[model samples]
Target: MIHPPDRPTELGPGGDNAIAHAMGVAADEWTLLILRYALQDGVRRTAQWQQVLPISSAVLASRLRRMTELGLFSPVEDEEGAAYHLTPRGAALWPVLVCIWAWEARWAEGHPLCLPRMRHLVCGHQFEPCMACRTCGGLVEPREVTGSFGPSGSWPRSAPNTTMRRRSSGSANLGPGFFPESRALIGNRWSAAMLGAAYLGAHRFSEFQRRLGAPATVIADRLRTFRSLGVLEVLGDADRTDRHHYRLTDKGRAFFPVVMSAIEWGQRWFLAPEGPAVVFRHRGSDHPFSVLLLCSACSRPLTGKEMTVD
Candidate 1:
């Protein structure tokens, strides 16, 4: 069982696992898109989804089923066909999506997909964070977050038994020691692209490499990184030697939102006239960047200036 980060026991309203849960939900790209579409455009049958999203039928089914099991979506049956709607737990993801989008819009190159304006629900502001917060209010830097195995955990099967696990603390003692393995798993240009490709349903290594046009060595490196991080794993007895056909592990699946948020950030800020390098949306509101930042103890809005540095 995964020991979660330190969070208020009396949750206002959210899933049990929080970080772990969200990571699982957001781990894949299509899953986030499924949620985003439902949230933004309202519920539509799976067929409708197939048009806008290029994901394969098998992958879509898997994503929908996983999300349903996680309580992010509730099955709704109607004349058109069966569709899914966001639950409260899923709806809570908007802020995270929005924040990520805002970041991307600024830092990354963008195309028409990257809209000129994004509405901040909190302040009813139509400006970017740089202008809204940095110019007007102030800036809030992302806490260099870390992870750990927590009180009860086990090294993955592939991980070295004597692997050196590094411990990192948040600005405040926000959580347990962070597992550095997680970063080595995902922290790379190709790693994120791999996840993004998965979100778009490019499963095979050749497909990923062809679409991304990355070097074979780069692809192999990312795959190995994810494997060691326990994010991706070799599936059943089929093609163990090929090493091209792999799927996301439960751990990697949970980390989707973090990747999605990051992609959304890239999409908004980094997109050029061509198009977004990546795009992500909130599963609930399809609003992206809906989660709030608050104190673990007081649950108060934790601002950048408010944090006391160690």
Candidate 2:
């Protein structure tokens, strides 16, 4: 078994990369799901989350403590026992969770255990949340915008020597036991690159092939898998070849945060000496707005110390 210091649970590169550091705080797979239940299902007690999610009690208790350390959860006393609730910072993850659920429902249709229907308060209909531009309110299409290197992007020069043994899942050295389905999906570098390219407006088979530079066979295999998984859907009537104009489904679009989070983390932790390879910004304005971890309540940036958890 790996020792505690060997696992290195703290996320992001330390020093100067505050967002990177913050992202590191909740890098565990179950933490996000814990936040999801707290935000959506009103699951406050430790037992409630353990019951609803596929997690063990030991793991649940550990993650709850970690999330508490990250300020994602706050303790509240009630009649029965100790309970947990989403702090505003924790509630901010609702969209990310909703999108994840939307993606799961899209890909895992007819599973019989799908989440209950979600109703949009504004439209009074089921709605899928989207990541849109803060400035334009348009979908956060990766291809439509350009950005420059932030301070964090320029520093680091290169990833320093570390014990991390990079693997397809990017967690070989980070220890074991974090085997979420989300990790399984983007475990491979090529799969993740393909998805990122898709978010960057690569709708066609040729587009994916060109952007990823992956061989035709690999591209075809990934595409077929994504199609089967409901992340990509064929544009049947686009006047193009069936395989040429695939698009992101509701679930695929909802997985944007996963992609964005990885990219955001990389922007700080892993960068070339030249700077960030790509940055996203709204077209209307010249100012580039990197995806920030902001609080849902005050719109301030999120750090773990702002609140406490029991």
Candidate 3:
């Protein structure tokens, strides 16, 4: 197992499970937005991000600094000053980004942001991302899946043993602890907003502060927390401290699923009045696509009622 240098055994911001902890860390929208721009738009400079997005200078910088500490990006000397580039670890989140876009476009209806079509380079066609079992390469279905608690042993008292409904049986019974943890970490309003801004390409401290409207201390605390969790790290010897580049670690990159899943849930349960906020398509085809969640082992699409609890 890849234990972070800092955290030896703790999981979840609240000490739940490893998966829950990851969700809590990634629940920040600004961070995800920053990652998105890095992956899709190749944005690297402070002004370049601000020029395209709505974030101010301070908050942007704060998030960037935090990201640098996570190892998601690196700072390189540029002709003008410096630019933040995504590391290989950070680049691994491309699928998650695609998943988020797919969920928003197909499920969430009218939002202001327009999604770009994603092309599947492997298939040579515009297609949405779907989950598949890493083990069997089959589609994962909810009913066929089951989960067991790990050593953490902190399962919420309310959810001791969960069960999945059988699609073929036509029973839609979902057990407790289905999500495995509370949405507290990512659900925080400030954290979500900041993460969203970061994903949009904000990188400078001032830029983050201006866009988030959050207190300096709040930004600092969250960034520090992310760094401590091994989600983000600092780049090379940066020219400036605040202007230093930040990047995501593999752990941080893994949180992409939580973000995408949350977006899908919001689109279905708590959509905005206008409908879906944004749409995503195959980048190569420039055509709309779909998002499917599959089992890592079975490769079947997972549904709420279909998952089985162990």
Candidate 4:
């Protein structure tokens, strides 16, 4: 029998599982689109978000309220209406957003609108953000990082409540200039967990099933989606489905920064009794891996205040 936490921990923000907590709030398609519009277009009011996004007023209000309760957004009542601004915690998600933009711009196909150019104001040049180690000041990649789970990192703790309904395929109608592929991969809790498991050395289909505790059909569906997105490749005998070894493709490996940034954001905002749910270490420096987003043009560290998207 599948045993979840004692409480209904699906969408609520309080939890010891930091990664799960982070995903709970930020890893939804609506949340990502809202954040994009807010950060890039300086959208703050309810009417403003509605004008830019296709989301209903009730859903937008609900998301805003939840984000406010989670410390990501603070609501201010004004003469017109309530305007929500990103808190420091919310502002810290700049790197994650930038990483998503970078991945989608580079890998995703058939964008209906042009993706915005991210400019580093300090360097006065448009650049792609690169992930680097905070300790040794070196570049970080999927292979160079090692992860270990703490007490809170159990599959039960990490898995979202399965009772939560999967999103409809047509629900992601965020107009143009939005992240479709990035949202497809990271926006879903199960898909994010499965991808993370792959990075943590879960290669075979059985391994993914074992680690994620997802249903066989759910696992299969996500694996197929990953393969279709060019994020994973099946090795060994294709006919032997059970023994098929799944590995990350180059495009998949490039998504490491997005994961790292999310992990860092989670560890920073969500507190667990057993410390961080998952601890990552840089192999070359052998130090705790801290994600630093740097500009490709000037190699300088990036901040939300310093970046202008156009």
Winning model by TM-score = 4
Residue 162 Cα positional deviation in candidate 2, in Å, after optimal superposition: 12
Clashes in candidate 1: how many?
42
lDDT of 3 by residue, 151-172 (tens): 4322231111221111221222
lDDT leaderboard ranking: 4, 2, 3, 1
Q: Sort the candidates on TM-score, descending order.
A: 4, 2, 3, 1
RMSD of each: 18.2, 9.6, 21.6, 4.8
- Report the candidate with higher lDDT, 1 versus 2: 2
For each candidate, the alpha-carbon lDDT, in order, equals 0.44, 0.53, 0.47, 0.77
Each candidate's number of clashing pairs is 42, 2, 81, 0
Query: On a 0 to 1 TM-score scale, where does candidate 2 land against the true structure?
Result: 0.54
What TM-scores do the predictions have?
A: 0.41, 0.54, 0.48, 0.90
- Candidate 2 regions off by >4 Å? 1-29, 76-79, 108-112, 147-149, 154-181, 186-254, 261-279, 284-310
Q: Estimate, for each residue in 1-310, the C-alpha lDDT of model 1 and write its tens digit.
A: 2111121122222212222233333334445556655655564667877766655687677777766655566778888677777765455455444444343344332232443454434444454332111122222222211122222111121012221122232222212111233334433345545655554556677877776677889877787776765667766555564545677665555444344444332222221333322222332232323223433344344332232211
> Which residue runs of candidate 3 sit more than 4 Å off their true CA positions?
1-17, 153-186, 189-310
What pairs collide in candidate 2?
11-24, 103-251
How many clashes in candidate 2? Answer: 2
Q: How far off is residue 46 in model 1, in Å? A: 1.6
The local lDDT score (0 to 100) that residue 107 gets in candidate 3 is 37
